[model samples]
Target chain A: MKNKLLVATRKGLIVFQRDAVSKWKVIGAHFNGIPVSMVYEDPRDGNWWVSLDHGHWGIKLHKSNDKGKTWEEVEAPKYPEGTLVKEGVDATLRYIWAFAAPSSDGSNSLLIGTEPGGLFRLNIQTSESKLNQSLWNHPSRTDQWFGGGRDYPGIHSIVLDPRNDQHMYVGISVAGVFETQDGGNSWMPKNKGLKAEFLPNPDAEIGHDPHILLASSKQPDYMWQQNHCGIYRTENGGDQWIDVSDRDGEAYFGFALAMDDEYPERAWVAPAQSDEIRVPIDQKLCICRTEDGGKNWNTLNSGLPQSYAYDIIYRHCLINQQDELFFGTTTGNLFYSSDGGDHWEALHQFLPMVYCLTWAD
Target chain B: MPKVSFTKALKRFYPTLENKIYIKGDNISEILDGIEEKHPGIKDYIVEENGQLRKHVNIFCGEDPIDDRITLSDMVGEEDEVFIIQALSGG
Candidate 1:
């Protein structure tokens, strides 16, 4: 029996399976300098999708039909330069930060969140069709999204309604959530209650830096995010958001959130470095859980150190493996949750800022 | 001479570089040059294009980060060691 785990490494996609205890068997590795953002294996199809840095390998996908035996690379949809953007600005898609599994309304597709903020779709064509992308580019919106990390929208996390795939939501760093009820043809900002930590007291800017944003396949509407200043949740399709920060005696706001696959309401998050002033809030470098959605929160620091970790965590980097929740902190510490986010233990000592973690068979 | 060593990250790429040899050099320059002549890419990765030690790359003469990043001309007598490591990032 091979226990496998998919790591979305800075290098390409690496499939790490244990031949036995304490031994790792990685296959079809990609590490020649291509930074991979997220890698997820579908339970139904037993396939792999690896998202790479935009400028390097945009919306790249890799699949393995054979039950974890050998893997194949997906031929991504390539758009010739000068087709979309005008001449100038040496732009190379440099980052793809997040990925989400598609739902029933589509071709069991894959959602890719890219740098400079944009959404992309991957094709799950058929048995004969090799792993490749059919749709490469989708604008963030029709009227140009208000404010992203920069001039354009850069996506960090994408979520789909478990029941209907057409209903989708995505989070753009330094901005807000965008929803598309019509299967991504057009989009609009879904953020109504969300707040931008970096936003000036006035309204000079319209966006905030997103540390981490997660939308579980199970509970698409129940989303979580750790932003530049606080942690928040929105149950009504980003129409209304709640500030779950500990600053006001409410549950401590976190930057890293891990939503369960089957249990959407139950999610995990961790206290991250916030603002230049205060000591790291709820900053145990520990992952906490909210059992009844984001209404309440608790700290799960058993077997975990109480010392304040220095690095800020990106929300999508947190994940759940079985009942266990896992996250990579800024200090290069990888924590795993066995009984949800209640108890965590260090798994890997250090790796280059673990951008994302995903489970496999 | 005091024995210096590379961290686990360094050992991964160069497994042969274990606690095998120890020598004293008059200066850090001579010591690193001697190492590069043996391990080609190691020095380049540790030292930057401007000939400065990369932030992630570190060295110690027993709890000291080699006094200076540039002036490696300090003499290392019969009891100095150099330790290198991967850049540490995150909280």
Candidate 2:
């Protein structure tokens, strides 16, 4: 099991370690008092990368070669000059929403998803970054894709097929899902079965909001997403998506999702009350788990707040490494589960508003 | 030459950042370039990729705020004091 946890919070990047007694405690904190948008560990080289959102200074990227001991600021991805989100809006790096390292062994490249719906490929060795023109120049982006929560559409999820480095999928708010089978040279919209209730045509080819997207590492073809309207699953590499939301239960709307790597039939979601009310379901905090591919959902709330709770989990806040699961909330609460979603224990309740959570060796 | 000063908050990143220094430039844009040469990567915090002042960043030429945020065409007098500050914002 991973023994260290990295919590990217609104105030800083915090590190927690499991002690000899198996208790998690704060081990270190970096970028104090600065909003950390994302903390990513490059799986290929174990390098720590952090994205900072300086309200006045613009966005920045930093990397640590020696764990969290030292850090050096690197070039944050930049949208090319004259690139426009629309007719006159010059595109810029508003936010670094997602980071993915190439699955191919010893590759010195990283993929970044940003606001204004630009995907960047960064060469780590030379620190040179370029926007993926194919995705940026997609036909529907300029006219059809608009902002959801942010002022501009953002790419927040990048899932690379572990079996094939060339195949990948990106999740964009208000723009739906796009798949690239040839290393991002081109992309095709994969929202065949998604519903955009806000649009005049709910079954339009694009403009579906997928809050978070995940794929089972063991079964790469099986994918799942916690969408704005409901929950969905794809069994055949996103050829078609099946709506599996619990209509009568408290599992219809949420932003965070986690999938079992070895079991394609199992998944988990932290459901909010609804899209309009961004809080725990019924004022109770619980994690809904599905053992039979979303056919049924079990509410797991043991050791969690039972009533009057108002914690909301962000898309990247819920993560799992085998049976050990961890999630941090926007309310600054962090919880850990040793045995899947059967139970949870509050690790810390007073950190900064947690943005994302990840584990390190 | 105009003397350029920065917000103390920047010292966290550029520990060796001097509170103030004289830079040779005729306009805000050229002055920023001179600052970047002295302290690498500091200019990005003040401006964006399009060379426009960040939304929440402000620059003052003596007691007057810079006029052209996009082109930064505001000229800096040789004896003027250029102050770069982070606008008070966010919770």
Candidate 3:
């Protein structure tokens, strides 16, 4: 089990360390009073990277080589000059949504997903970044893609196949999923079975909002996504997707999703009421788990708030390490579960509005 | 030469930032370049990659706000006091 947990919050990045007795406590806090959009631990080299959303200043990126003690700011990825979100609107870096290390074995490259739907590849050693032109120039982006909740479409999820780093998939708000085979030189839409009720054409080739996408590390071909309209799963490398949302329960709409690495048939989702009402179902907080590939969902609410709770989990908040799970909410509540989703315990309830959670060494 | 000052909020990131410094430039753009030379990477906080002033940043040339936000073409006098202030916003 990881001893340290990094909580990226609206106000700062909080580091929690597990003591000798297995009790987690606040170890340190960095970037206080600043919104940390994302905190990523590079698996390759243990470098801590944080993306900051300075409300007054522009977006900034920083990396820490000595855990959370000291940090060095790196040049944030910038959209190329003359790049347009549309015909007249110039593309700017609104937010840094996601970061992924392409290789876990001493690779110096990192992939970043940003708002305005630009994907950047950065060299950590050189502090140089280049925008992936293939995805940016996708023709459907101009006509079919638009924002879901934000003002502009954003790339929130980047999943690289464990077997092949070059084969990757990115999830974009209001733009469905796109897959690349030859290291991002080209991409193709992978939303064959997704449904977008908000769009005029429900079966359009693009414009599907996948709130979060997760691919199993054990079986990369199996993927799961908590979509805006419903929950979906792909068993054959995204050749087609299957709608597995719980029609009779509250699993149809939500953002956070966690999948079992060894068992693709098992997954978890923190379900909200619906799109219009972004609260827990029936004012009760429960985590729904599926053991048989979304055929049935079990509501796990042993130690969770059952009434009058209004905590919402962001897409990057819910994560799992084997049977242990951790999640942070927008209401500044953090919870931990030692035995999957069957039970949970509040770790902290007074941190900043938690944006993302990741386990580190 | 114009004396350029920054909002104290910036000291959180760039702690060594002086209260004010003299820079040699004839316009806001050139002044920003001179400031960047003195304190590396400080200019990005005020302006964007396209050289447009960030939406929430304001640059004042003496008594008036800079007119040209894109190119920052507002001229600066030798004795001008250039102020880079973060706009009042956010919760």
Interface RMSD of each: 11.3, 0.7, 0.8
lDDT of each: 0.58, 0.92, 0.92
How far is A298's C-alpha from truth in model 1 (Å)? Answer: 1.9
TM-score of chain A of 2: 0.98
What is the lDDT for A7 in model 1?
A: 61
Q: RMSD, each candidate, Å?
A: 12.1, 0.9, 1.1
TM value for model 3: 0.98
Candidate 1 lDDT over B1-91, as tens digits, reads 6466777755544567774356456777677777777776556546543355655566776666677777576567677676665556422
Residue A40 local lDDT, model 1: 69
TM-score of chain A of each: 0.76, 0.98, 0.98
Stretches > 4 Å off in candidate 3:
none
The C-alpha local distance difference test score for the whole of candidate 1 amounts to 0.58
What DockQ class does candidate 2 belong to?
high
Mark the regions of model 2 whose C-alpha exceeds 4 Å error after superposition. none
Q: What is the TM-score of each candidate against the true structure?
A: 0.64, 0.99, 0.98
